[model samples]
Each structure stands twice: as structure tokens, then as C-alpha cells.
Target: MGSAVSSAAFSTRPGLLDGLDPEQLAAASAPRGPVCVLAGAGTGKTRTITHRIAHLIQSGHVAAGQVLAVTFTARAAGEMRARLRGLGVDGAQALTFHAAARRQLRYFWPRVVGDRLWDLLEGKLRLVAQAANRAGVATEAEVLRDLASEIEWAKATLVSPDDYPAVAARTQRDTPAPAAQVAEVYRNYEKIKNSAQVLDFDDLLLHTTAVLEEHGDVATEFRDRYRCFVVDEYQDVTPLQQRLLNAWLGGRDDLTVVGDANQTIYSFGGASPRPLLEFTRRFPEATVVRLERDYRSTPQVVSLANKVIGAARGRPAGSRLQLIGQRPDGPEPRFAEYDDEPAEAVAVAGRIRQLLDAGVPASQIAVLYRVNAQSEAYEQALSELDIPYLVRGGERFFARKEVRQAISALRVATSRPSGADVVEQVRTALAGVGLTEQPPPGGAAKERWDALLSLVELAEELAATVQDADLARYVAELEQRAAAQHPPTVEGVTLASLHAAKGLEWDAVFLVGLAEGTVPIQHADGDDSAIEEERRLFYVGVTRAREHLSLTWALSRNAGGRRHRRRSRFLYGLIPEDHPAARVARAQGKTFGGATARCRVCGGGLTATLEVKLGRCARCPSNVDEELLERLKSWRSDRSRELKVPPFVVFTDATLVAIAEQRPADDGALVSISGIGATKLERFGAEVLAVVRAAGRG
Candidate 1:
């Protein structure tokens, strides 16, 4: 509280952090009631906050465990922790709101929740889902699953069943069910959870807030423990999260929140940026930082994103998040419309194969869509083409019973140090699944659950040796990787709903299912804001493409000849003046695809192929040798099989074909090929050239 403590405790010299500008540093270092960083994608807002945390800790202002950094996702939290460690502040508690809530609930479950909570909650949900299905409220299991999600969201937003009709009538009234029914269902769910003496995910935060509110001393303890806080993706913080944040701060804490108002796409989940945007007004001492330099995308992609955003007038203006396109330039955003879903899928698959033949890798390509429903076509095509893909934001890892049980066991083992919870939960969930027929001999369950228990034990040992601040992060990261076959798709070729895909970027993005009832979203047209949001959604989708961008729309979908729908308004907006799509809808284009070449003599297709990304039509004089193409394709196929990614993904059909046709004799020749930019050349240039040379020899 004294001048010496204030000056000595927290200070940062300019240039200590990489990626952040001096302005960002000043804003981040400022101790204040509130600070807002309005940054575009990849301008290093993340880097700024990270260094800020490091500065706070190193200056002796905020103790290691006293600083809390909250992110929108568990993965993002892990990333921030890792980055902070890189900056020499390894112990800051970087966490997602839900994760923090979970910790709080677990630490005080006995006092706040009593002992009978867990079993009661689970049984209640099970019974409700069963009854709902039998009562014809929801006929199918999938419908029940959706209902369960709705139930959770409603509760998390603190919406009571009595409040459902009013809330539902006010927001998204067009949804199928009446507000009263929704309210009834919610009422039932609460009853069930209470009867079972258990809490669902929502209850974690709600109960934590309740505990803090009721126990002033405990709230004060936490506030004193973490004097400084940083939250990333602040635009998406829900009301529940805001409550938690308020509770943690105890009305006064140094806070830094960074987000883009344009990226406020998670409103369905109760996420909003009003809190972030209003920070300065709400807290008189708040400082605002705006970042416009886009280090993640190309000028072309950024310009398009800007234009799309411009089309939506209401959003708060900030620095333009431009794209500093990293990969070698290949193609601009493409626009295409197909006859139907299957044909569109086929075309996309063939394009990948062609790109593979040229030289682009499967790992560098992604097929993104507006909804999960659209993935079916791409999934089928990729499966047929033998493409290996990881879907992003598809399912929550904790939602998987197996993964949850495993993680819970791991947490228990880590918490107890001696591995008690691992023994308890595994036995409990296993018994529910009928995995354990009879009670295990004393300690037998713990011994049998070796895989998870061992990890818990390792975490326990890690905690003792590692600093407490670092122990949580260490455990979180290990659990993240160990909890699944794949880390929930933070990277790779991301297949995501446009909504979920809002904040991320990729090397090449293929936007599929750009048809009506999908992009504008069937219900989004009535409200002007909704329409603008749709446009913003399209903009979000297009901006995700760092280099190559493609949009595809199918006229129809035929599942056993039950023909489906029309082109999406989004695609309709892409047609050129002379194109038919323009007449029907306002389509414009500097379209990527024009015409497919066919041989004049044999009428055989003259498919243009790529060697990585250098494209050449079959008729191009610079084509690689036929035998070389065969060999390169064969080798690539083998690698693709091993990796499980589609062959096109392994290498674009175009890239493969270019290697064969343009037999790059050396590095110079290789660089001459398209898409063979500096990074690719440095990473795989020698091997790629060797493959070309060897193929030519064979």
C-alpha cells in the first residue's frame, strides 16, 4: 500500500516482451481499476498480457498464486500458462472460468454441497433424459441430448423455468418449443439435481458464487490471494463468468481484458462483450488499448474481413485486424456453387487430390463449415479419399464419459497426492457402467486403475518438487494431452462451425455448406442485427483463411434420393455480374475456379496438378514426368495411409502432379514452383527436391 511497495512491487521496462509493441506494454503495465485491449487477431494481445503477468510477479507486486488469468477455453488457459512460463513467470494461475469454478466447488464441496451431491445430480439427469424420451417430450436420444444442453445453458445463465417463457419469448422466440414447456423442463431439472443432492456444470459456478457471497472472509481471502487478473477473449465472458470475476475481485482488483468486439460470436452461450466495451465507463480509471496490426493474415484476407465487418454497422470500431499471411501465396478466396451436396463433396475431394498432385499437404488444408451438419459430406469424402482430419470445437472433452472419468480420477490422484479420488471415482463410474461386477478387494481398484492412477501419482510427485503456482499448470497440460486421443482441435486442419471458428485462423480454409438456411441461418433474417451478424459470420468464415480460401454451396442434398435444398444467401452473394447466381441473388466474384481443362483429342480430362502448391494444367509445358508422378503419388499415398490424413492433405494432388510434371531438379527449381514459399522450402525443401529428383531418375 506504501509508495515503496507500489514502486518496487510492480514495474516493467520497455522491450522485455517479444511480439508486443511499446504501446501495448504501457497499457498492460498500468495498474488500474480496468483496462481494455481492443486487438485484432494475432497482434500479440496474448503476448502483452502474459508479459504483464510476468512483470507483476517479478516486481513483487502480485504474488505468483495471487494473480489469476482467465481464458475462454481450457486449451487457451493452458496456452497462456505455457507462454507465461516462457516469459519466466511459471506459477500464475491461468484458468478457464469453468475450471476455476470446478476447483472452488471441489475444495469446498463438503461445506457448500454436502456429501450426497454427486450421485444425486447424475441420477437426476439420467432419470430426466429417460423420462423426457418416454413422455414424448423429445422422441429421440439425439433430441434429448440437445435438450440437456439447453437445460444446462439456461441454468448457467441463471434462467429459472418460471422465467423461461418470458426469456424465451423475448429472445429467439422462433425456436420450436414454447417458453412454458422449456420453463417446465428447467424446473424439473433443478428439482432433479436438488433431489439427488448434486450439481451439474452450471451449479459449479453458481454454487461457487453462492459460497463466496455467503462467506465474506473466504471471498476476501481469494481476493487477497490474487490481486491481479488477466482475461483473454473477454468478449465471450458470460453473465455467470462476470459474476465470478466480480466475486474474485471483491470490488477492487487490477484487471486486464483483451478481445475484439467484432468477434463476439458466442451469444448463444450467453457470452457478450458489453462488459468489455463498457469497462471504461463502468470503471472511471480504466485504460483502453486498441491494436490494428494484423500479424496473422494476408492483406487480401484482412481486407475482405474488414469489408464484411463494414457491412455490419453497429459494432464498435477498433483497429483493423489485418492478416500477415505467413505461407507462400497460392490463391485468393474462391467462390463455387455445386449441383448438390455429394457433387460438392466430390469436387472438394478432387480438388484436394489435385492439390496433392501439385504439392500441397493435407495437414495444411482445412474444410470448415457454418454448422456441424455440413461436415457429413466433407467427412465422407475425406474418408473415401483416406484423409485424416481432427474436428475442432465439435465435442467437449469433459462431455465424454470415458474422458471425464479418466480426468476426474487424474484430478483426485493429483489432489490427494496419495491417489485417493482416482480410486473413488473410477470405482464409482465403473460400477455404473457395470465394469466392476463385484466390489474390488481392498486397494485392488486403485491397483487395477493403473494407467490413470500412475499419472495422478506423477502429478502428486510433481507438485512437491514443482512450485505450487506451477503445479496446477503442470497437471493441467499433462491431463489435457492424456485425456484424449487428440488434444481438442486447437490447431491442425480445423473443421469448425463458423461460430466456434470465429477467433482462429488456418493456412488454407475451405468453407463448405454455404447454402440457404445455413449461413444467414434460417432464423437470422428477421432482426437487422441478426442479418448483420450473419454477414459478420460470413466475414468471420472468410477471414479464417490465412492464404487459400474457398467457399462452396450445393444446390441440393440427396440422402437416398430424398433431395434437399437451395443455395445459401451467403453463396448467392459471391456470384459475378455475368454469373447466373447474380441474377437470383447478389453474387459477385473474383472467383478462383474458372474452367476445368479437357483434352481436345481423347476428350480425357486435362487435370491441372500441384507440386505442393505450384499449379500446372496437364497441357502446361512445365509439367513433371509421368513416371515421376506415379512414383511421387505412390510414396505420398503410403505416407497418407500411415498418417491417416487424406492423400490430398498429405500433399495436394496439384502439388504432387507439379512435382512429377515440373521435376524440380534442385532447390532453385523447387522454389520456382507455386506455394513453395520460404517456410516450406526451409522445412521440407531438400526432401521435396530429392523426391522430385529421385522420381525423375526412376
Candidate 2:
């Protein structure tokens, strides 16, 4: 009550405890000492944590500048900052562990290290390659990549090269090479990186930890600067990250963390739910709150999600969240058994079509699968039906460098106090930074340009679609995106891997390719822990649906093929035998493990149809911008027809690609394209620029 934020300003913000459920209110109000909020899927974890920070600042317990909130992703951090601003609090630092560490490293490296810090490598591959060569380990590009991941895992788990061989063997890690060879490569990598004075992302935390552990003054300053700390996704903290966090905290205990142990799906990436599960052990007096209400999904969807996770074996005792659905009742989840993969994809797409026709926005529908390979069939089926869709890859969206840089610029501009509208402010901030009208044909430079252009379009959209929108409002929208992992509503259905579907929700969700080997995944076959993770993944997918939820599995890989596949084991005890799902599987054929397949119902011997993802999946760009670039291309396509010339004649693919990537909106911009001279600009500049302008206006 004694904080700088006056009662008048705080009253208008209903999000601070006023709107919180009882459990959230308890977690948010207990803004002192150690607090752990066990947030379930679909629960308002972001809301609760943001409100807790707001309450701490607004109620005078902590100043906004003294509080630090950390999440796992840039977008999530952005989301927290936006929400705090909405609650009339500002100046708090909400960032990913890497972002926070990098900020500190940038500031203190000179003072602590007595010189500038080493260049942080954007990627580890080039360095890993050199290390492989130095260590006499011959590797192709793919093998190099796998080794890079192995190195990352070792670093994340705080394992040294000396530790990796034993650790990998102990954990049964599927090493790309023999454990000893991989460890040798890892050692060479460290030696090379040190010699070159370069550090990879994981090293960012390692170096920071070393600095703090080795330097007293820097650690003191960091701890003083951030008195109160909040960490989101506590379940997914790698051991290296926890070390960095501990270094930041020094000996302080003013911390709050939110996570669900049951949602621990990133063990392969060195994330464990142990920190969340054992929070009370470290701080015996810690206030632990469990958020069970499922606010994002219908009761039907929530019940199914709860059921799915309920069957998971070997889960830590009391770790699972028994979700209590809070939304109005919706239809029971639908289950289907297809004769083949093609039939399943077609059936899923057909139902999606019906849902789209009935008025569910394409953006509110998603087809979630276990692995990227399963997407091909759905992609073909959706394309055949003339449905627009996005196939999501692995990389986190807001973690892109261009996006982070653009946001940093926006923040700087916001601090200066701009006179222009939100969109204009963004454009001015990004003017020469990357949002040029013309751009390169390919590579990172073009990707950077496209990211900035998308931000501009996002600003334009907010300015037009929102009432009296400003930079603050635009930031808030980004916050919403960060909180949900939902990008701006693209005008297409989303096809994402289940891991990609975490922290996101939809009105209609179709979970496809739920056969045994695909769902539990072949790698999980021998490991109980890995199998449990797969079950958690299934729970994540189930909870994403708000209304219509259809789950399908193929009995075979091809039409009229041997019915050797079986439904996911996770689905077995969840869906009843009398259900159409089980009936259909029974009618086709039921097969579990081994080459010899037997029908579950009739005891008939059947041939096998292998379900594979890792071996069969195709690879593609892991990061794609869903921005005005796509819209500009679509508009350019229309112009191609109206000009009464072939599309290429109107503008070569290179020029058009440039136009789309740059989102050029003026004559100067158009003429700068590779093939677009003054003549072409005179002919089609208005048309091309108009698309960018329209995209800006939403």
C-alpha cells in the first residue's frame, strides 16, 4: 500500500489478485520468501506469475526495478513484461536465463575479465566441426549436427568431457558416436573454443557462473540489482541454467517459481522436473500452491487430458496435476482408427474442413502429431483439400536474433518517447536496421529483414484493429503471444509437433499419427523414463483443445497394407473398448511389438506395418517467419495476373522473393530490388507497396 503506485492507478488494473482464482491469489499474494506454484496445463500460469510481480511492485514490497522474472523463451519474457506494464508496473527485468546472463556478461565482462568478453558463437556447429577434425573424428554434416547436440546436452547437464562418457552410459544416452569418441570430440571442442576466444550459448551461462563464483563484486552487484526473482517453467531448467540462477541469487531466498512436474518433456535437452518436485526440500518453509483449474480448455478436453496423464507409470509421486476443467461442457473427445496413414490424414483434414465451414477460424484449429515426419501426410491431405496450413518446426519463434534485436530497438525508442503512432514508431526504429524495401536473395540477412518487417506489420495490425493503440499496446500483444507460444493469428491451420504445441491452445485440435512406435516413439521403447515423457507429451497435446478434439491412429502405413500397427499405449486405458475408436481398431487388426502381429479381438495372425519417425522424417528450415512477407507474395501473385503477363515476366521469382522478404512499401523500396529497375517500379511499385500497407492496416 506504500509503494509508488498509487491506489487510483492500481484500482484500474483488475489483473492484480482481483481477477485471480483462490489458488492464484494465494501464490501471487505470498510474494515473499520461496514460493512454488504447480501450474497445470491450461491453467493461467502466466497470469498468476505476472500478477504476483505486479502485486509486489504495486504494493510496495518490491520496486519494479528490483524484481527479476525469468522464463525459458524470449517470447515468454516479453509476455511477462507486457503484462506487468498492463498492471501499472514498469522497469522490471523479465528475460530468459540466457538473456539475463548475456546482459550481465556484456556489462561485467570488461570489469571482471579485464577486457572485452569473447565473441559468443551464434551456433556451435562450425566450432564443433573444427573440433571433430582436430580430434581425428571424421563426420558428415548430419553427424556433426548430432555431435553438436551431444555437446549441448553435456554442457546443459553440467557434464564435462571427462564426465560425458560415464554420464552418457549411465543415462543410456543415444550417442551419435561411441561414448568415448564423442567425449574426445567434446574435449577438442572446448579446447578449440578457448583457443579461438569464442563461447557457445551454453557457455554463456557457464562463464557467467564462473565469473560470479570467481568474482565477489560482480555477484554482489547482480544480487543487489535484482532483489526478488520469479522463474517460469521451472520444470524445464537445465542444470547449467540452475547454476547461473544460483549465481545470480547468491544467498538470497526472495524467489517465486511456477511449473508442473508432470509437464517435464525436455529431458533429452537436460531439463528435469526434479527441481520443481523437490522445491520444498531446499526451502523447507516454501509456500507451494497447485493450480488445477483448466481455464483454457472445455471440461471435456480437460477430463481427457487428466485421464491421459493419469495412466502414466513411474511418474514422481504427487507430481501429476489432476486437471479440474473449469470451462463449460463440450463434446467428448472423438477417437478414430484408420486402415492406413493416408486415410487417417484425409479423415482428419475432412473433419477440419467441416469445422472451418462451421466458422471456427483457421487460426483456432491445429493438427498436432508426435513427430515432424507425420506432418507430410497431413500436409498433402490439407493441400489437396485447398486448405491453408503451417507446418511448425522445432526452433522457438521469438528466440530468433532478428526479432530480439528489433524488440531491443523498440524498447529504446519507447524510452525516448516517440510522437509517431505505434506502427510508424516501429518503422522508424527499424528504418535502416533491417526493414529495407529491397533485400538479398537468401541466407541470414534476408531472414533478418523478414523478421523486422513482420514486427512492423504486427504494429500496423494493432494500430488498426485495436482502439487507440500505441507502442505499449503493441508490446502487450507480443506479451500475449509470449505467454501462449501462439504467434499472431495467421490465416491458416497449424500443424505442429506435440512439443511445439506446449503453452498453446486451440478451439479445435486433431491429434494424428497415434500408433505405438510413433506416439511412445521408437527411442522410448526400452526406457521407462522416456516412455513417461512421451505420455506427458500426449497430455500436452490433449489439453490444447478447447472444443472439438479428435484423435486418430493408423492400423497400417498404407492403404490395404498389413494391419500391424496399434494405437498409442497412452490411449489404451483412457478410451473405452466400446468406443468407436477401439471397435475400428479391433475390426482392422491389433498389433503391438515384434514382426509377428496378432489381432487383439479375433486372435488372427496378421502382417506388420512398421511405424517409424526418426528414420523416415524429412528435414526442413527450422525457423520460418509467418509475417507480411507471405502476404506480400500473395498480393504480388494477384498483380501477376492483372498485369496480363506471366508471373515471372511481371517479376522474376528472385525479385518477387525480394519484395516479399522486404515488404517494401514505397517507390524507393521497389526500385531497389535485384531485378526491379525504375521501369518495373513504375509499372508495379504501387501494387507491391499496397500489399505491405494493407498488411500494416490489418
Worst 10 residues of 2 by lDDT: 609-618
Work out the TM-score per prediction: 0.68, 0.74
Report lDDT (CA) for all predictions. Answer: 0.62, 0.76
Q: By TM-score, who's the top model here?
A: 2
Cα RMSD (angstroms) for every candidate in the order listed: 13.1, 13.1
Error of 1 at 184 (Å): 1.8
lDDT of candidate 1 over 500-615, digit per residue (tens): 67656677778887777887888786777677667767877887777777777776665223436666654543445565432111123112246433333344444322211344
Which residues of candidate 1, in runs, are more than 4 Å off?
A: 1-11, 113-127, 130-139, 317-330, 354-361, 393-477, 483-493, 558-698
Cα error, residue 28 of model 2, in Å, equals: 0.9
Model 2 lDDT tens row, 502-611: 77789999998888999989888988888989988888888888889998899888756898988888887777667767333333433322233343234454332221
